[model samples]
Target: MKHDRPKISDVARLAGVSTATVSRALSAPERVSEETRAAVQQAVEATGYRLNLAARNLRHRRTGGIVALVPNLANPFFSQILSGIASVLGPAGYNLLIADTRTADAQTLLDYAEPSRADGLIILDGTLPATALQGRVPVVEACEWVPGLPAPRVKIDNRAAAGLAIGHLADLGHRRIGHVAGPRGNVLTEARLSGTAEALAARGLPFPEEHLYPGDFSLDSGREAARIWLDQPAATRPTALFLASDAMACGFIGEVQRHGLRVPGDLSVVGFDDIELVAHISPPLTTIRQPRTEIGRAAAERMLACLKGETREADTVLPVELILRASTGPAPA
Candidate 1:
């Protein structure tokens, strides 16, 4: 009842050729004689023989698979990104394997790069170290971490995105603006925070050192950040808050609500990453729209190129946009 998979040996026997000839004809057809190639092709169809990809790749020094590293797989924003990555790699005869690096230790990133298991890697976590990644495998950074390694990457201009947030608030007459930056050491967080400061300075607005709060790019951190912001004197309180993530913004909003305050009425808020629920929330978030799918697709394409040695080290940055919604309004008079 079980039909055995047709093998190269079967094809070689039917084609009246050696197994080496069959291998070369299938993998590197250019090396085989035209007559031998035709015979192998005909036998391949007659016997319904599919090349043993695993064996052939082993012989040819290839894994034929790729690994993706993610910081948090549960985040809805990453779902679209994963879809885009799959769309690109699936058709190219590559299987995607995900490594949730957060669950793994910091040093374990190297262990997952075994060339026998995965030909290359795409890392979404930016906090990883450069030395741990060197010469292990071809790697590409997508959206999050980049260690200035000789690898290709694709991301948004974090500083520019942050500037967009600041400008939006300043235009709405928010003179006392505060920022809830991402985790302390994250490059994205630092870039955005720097951009926020730069935008304020350009507009001649004050960038109070005390107004910046540290967060870990989570909802709970956002809520705690609001408490820190509230503890400041009323006069020094930021009339508007620019949070690094939508979840964070939501946390801030929730905390403010528990304190009997309303968004845009008592405290205006802007968030980064226009996540799925932002529009549906009571006060729709004003935020930056990151091209999540594009980030994934671009990273995949770049990784493929790296595997093929078609491209060297490079940085690819996607654009971002500001989405205005109810969460932000003219600063409270």
Candidate 2:
């Protein structure tokens, strides 16, 4: 004959704690003392107790999971953000489901917004139309967002952050600075481009429209911008550059070297997004740190609130900081 399964009451009895205390230990251990938690854990191991997640989910009428919809899974920038999100949600016993928009077909992509798939959603793609997310599940926008989207947003002040990047370049005495722009239609690209323009004007620096090169915020785009600079006369080409993303800045730097140009000695460059790769690259990149971990944690919190029928604020904009590194220096004499 099969042995009977251990129950919650058995665990509580073994631990010498009330059933409520046992539940609390499993659900919110932080609310209990360390000694109490240890006893409950010991009781669980002794009784061979395991949580019945299916039964709990059935009773609560909820899936114990949330989905994060990222535009690109390959981009390392999203990795830290996802880690931060997991750190917050995991402690609460919620599973994280990663949905990569790039891999999904148009038909399957919209399924992410469906409430039936997960309890909530954290959308990191700004280009998706607001109408696409009209499902019943609560939604939070992180890193990027589309205007008029009703969901809560947790991100940095992109325009101001971009302005900070450019201001740093200006302070270095580089009046004739070039910019590697992001994709044309992206909200980030628009905000950063406008901010760069404003910063240049405020500094009373030169910004020839021709110097505003088109880029897709990719390594190839960065290399192309560098090639265009190479085509220009050495005396007229800008002494400094402010790339839209660290990936692009790194590409530009590598290509410039391949073409026999010295960074800082020949060209000073500043990049946006202080990604990990930026720090390890030769002559580390000076960039605006977006606090990816903070943004991710905040987004998870906001989503949790929304799921609880709370009315969260429209947007929470975190501050950005400029990280000075070996990539930037005083303008060439």
Task: Report the C-alpha lDDT of model 1 over 36-57, residue by residue, as the tens digit.
Answer: 9999999999999976677766
Model 2 residue 114 distance off true place after TM-score fit, in angstroms: 2.3
Ten-residue region with minimum lDDT total, candidate 1: 51-60
Error of 2 at 302 (Å): 1.2
Give the CA lDDT, 0 to 100, for residue 202 in model 1.
94
RMSD of each: 4.1, 2.4
What's the residue-level lDDT of 153 in candidate 2? 89
How many clashes in each structure?
1, 0
On TM-score, the candidate that comes out on top is 2
Error of 1 at 224 (Å): 0.4
